[model samples]
Structure formats: C-alpha cells, structure tokens
Target: MIVGEQKPIAEIKEMVAPYKKLLVLGCGTCVKTCFAGGEDETAVLASAIRLVSRKEGRTIEVEELTVERQCENEFIQEAAEAVGRNDSVLSLACGAGVQAIARRFVTKPVLPGVNTTFIGVLEKQGLFTEECSGCGNCELALFGAVCPVTRCAKKLLNGPCGGSQAGKCEVNPDTDCAWQMIIERLKILGQLDNLRAYVPPKNWNTSTSGGPRKLVREDHII
Candidate 1:
C-alpha cells in the first residue's frame, strides 16, 4: 500500500487561512490505513481548524467529507456537489489523489494535506516499512521473494557487498543485509543454485525514470 503522513496543523492552517469556505476531503484507502487522511482524521482536522480560526477572531466554515477513494473517478464523482460548494479543497490523500481531484476540478484549488511517503507494508500496528520501489519489472522469483533492489542499500544484484558484517548492512547497522536474507532464504528453500544465473543490469527505463506510466486493460475498455 502507499504510505503517507499528514502535514502539521500549523502548515495546514496556513494553507487554508485565505479561504473562508474550505472543504477538507479525505480518502478512505491507503491514507486511511496509515491514519493520515480518513473520515475520522478529516473531522479532527476540521475541528482543529475551526478552533484556531475562532481564536484568531476569524470566521471560517469547514466542510468535511470522505470518499471511498480519491484516485478513482467513480469515487471522486461522489464528492462533486460538496466540492462545487466549497471555495477551496484541502485533499488529505496521496499525491495521486490530490492530482486526480485537481484534474477533475480544473478551476478549484486543490491543496495537498499529506506527504506521500512510499510503497510499503504494515509491519505491525502503527509501523509501516517500505518494501517495494515499483521498478515496473519484478524480480522476486530470482531472489526467494526478497527484493534486493529495495532492501539493499547499494541495490546490488549479484551478491552481498563485502562491507556486510554480522548479517547486518554496512550502510546501516540497524538494517539486515538484504543479500544475507536472500541467501538464507535460498538455502532454506534448497534453491541456492538460482544465484548462479547471472542477472543483467536492471532496465531503469521500465521505472519512473521513463516518466509517468499507464496500464490499459483492453478487455475492460468500453
């Protein structure tokens, strides 16, 4: 899932200070899971804004709404009426979601409320760890499901860098050496010979280096 963190209240206050009628839009997908921008978060932020505005002797009207998802047009359409009524929108979604809303409502100012962090997984409650870089090409099968591209500090493809010590990464002692984990996993699966096959240099063209990407399913198209 895409992980993100909410902007501080002071910054958000500044962003919406100019608008009298502001809409705090929440996305109930990735940002929800990370506790950044969900229905509950929207309400909290709206109340906070109201409190601050009141203390400053200013009257600000905040409308709060949460869509199933802010990235998809179908879900975004649900907030059309609310969006049209507001002077400006503070989108508490991922960068993609904020852009999607901005694209749909070309005239409205869509302000981002959260900083998009990375593609990662929930390691435990309240702890999310990045696990993928979305390189476009997946090579997990070659490394026993451990992606050296993301886990390795050096992104080494062949073997562990000589600097690894005590099964920990040389770049950061707190991090486990990705190669070490790969080798141990391969040994347990009795597939150590897979390392013998040489992997060519990664083709970065398939990644973000090639610019924005798109996928079309011909079967699902109208």
Candidate 2:
C-alpha cells in the first residue's frame, strides 16, 4: 500500500493562513489505513486549524470531509460540495491525491497535508517499512520474493557484498542484509539454484527513466 506521514501542524498553518474558509479533505483508503489521513484525522486537523486561528485572532472556518479515495473521480465527486464551499482545500491524502484534487478543481488551491513516503506494507501495528521501489520490472521470482533493489543499500544484483556480516547489513547493522535474507529464503524453498545464473544490469527504461507512467486496461474500458 502507499504509505505517508502527516505534515507538521506549523507548516499546515502557514499554508492555509491566507484562506478564511478551508476544507480539510481525507482519503479513506491508503492514507486512512496508514493512520495518516482518515475521517478521524481529518476532523482532528480541522479542529486544530480552527483552534490555532482563534488563538491567533484570525477568523478561519474549517470543514472536514473524507472520501474513499481522492485519486479516482468516482470518490472525488463526493467531496465536490464541501470543496466548492471552501476557499482552499488542505488535502490530508497522499501526493497523488492532492494532485488529483488540484487537477479537478483547477481554480482552487490544493495543499498537501501529508508527505508521500513510499510503497510499503505494515510491518507491525505501529511500524511501516518500505519494501518496493516500483521499478516497473519485477524480479522477485529470482530472489525468493526478497527484492534486493530496494532492500539492499547498494542495490547489488548478485550480492552478499563483502559487507554482509552475521546476516546483518554492513552499512546499517540494524538492517538485515538483503542478500542474506534472500539466500536463507531460497535455501528454505529449495531454490538456491535460481541464484547460480548471472543477472544482467537492470533496465532503466522501464522505470523512472521516461517520467510519469500510466496503465490502461482495454478489457475494463466501457
């Protein structure tokens, strides 16, 4: 899932300072699951903004709304009324969400309330770790599902680089060496032979090399 963290309140205050009527929009999908921008968070942020405005002798009206997603028009339409009523929108969603709202409401200012971190999974109740770089081309089958591209500090294809010590990464002892984990996983699956073949340099064209990416599903198109 896409993970993100809420931006500092001080910075949020500065951004919405010019707007007397502000809408705090939340995304109930990715950001919500990450505990960054859910319905509860949206309400809390709106209240905080109002409180700060009152304390500063500024009269700002803040409203809160949460949509299932801000990236798609289907969910975005739900917030149209609230957005139309506000002077500006403070999006508590991911960067993509902020941009999506901006693209739809071209005249209104859409400010990001959270910093998009990365594509990752929830490692634990309170911890989220990055696990993928979205390199376009997937090579997980070759490494026992452990991606060395993002996990390795050096991004080595055939690695254990001299720095792997006691199953820990040399650059950061706190981190488990990607190669070590890969080898251990392969050994368990009885697929250690997968690594014997040489892996050539990764193709850059499939990833960030060309700029923004898009996917079209011809079957889904009506």
Which candidate leads in TM-score? 2
Once superposed on the true structure, which residue ranges of model 2 sit more than 4 Å away at CA? none
Which candidate comes out best when scored by lDDT? 1
The weakest ten consecutive residues by lDDT in model 1 span: 152-161
lDDT of 1 at 153: 91
RMSD of 1: 1.4
Give each model a TM-score.
0.94, 0.96
lDDT of 2 by residue, 1-222 (tens): 999999999999999999989999999999999999999899999999999999999999999999999999999999999999998999988999999999999999999999999999999998898899999999999999999999999999999799899999999898999999999999999999988989999997778886888889999999
Candidate 1, residue 178: how far the Cα is off, in Å: 1.6
Give the Å error, residue 121, model 2: 0.8
Go through the candidates in order and give each one's C-alpha lDDT: 0.94, 0.94
| TM-score of candidate 2 on Cα atoms, chains taken together | 0.96
Question: Candidate 2, after superposition: displacement of residue 10 in Å?
Answer: 1.2
Q: What lDDT is reached at residue 203 by model 2?
A: 91
Q: Candidate 1's residue-wise lDDT over 130-170, tens digit each? A: 88999999999999999999999989999798998999999
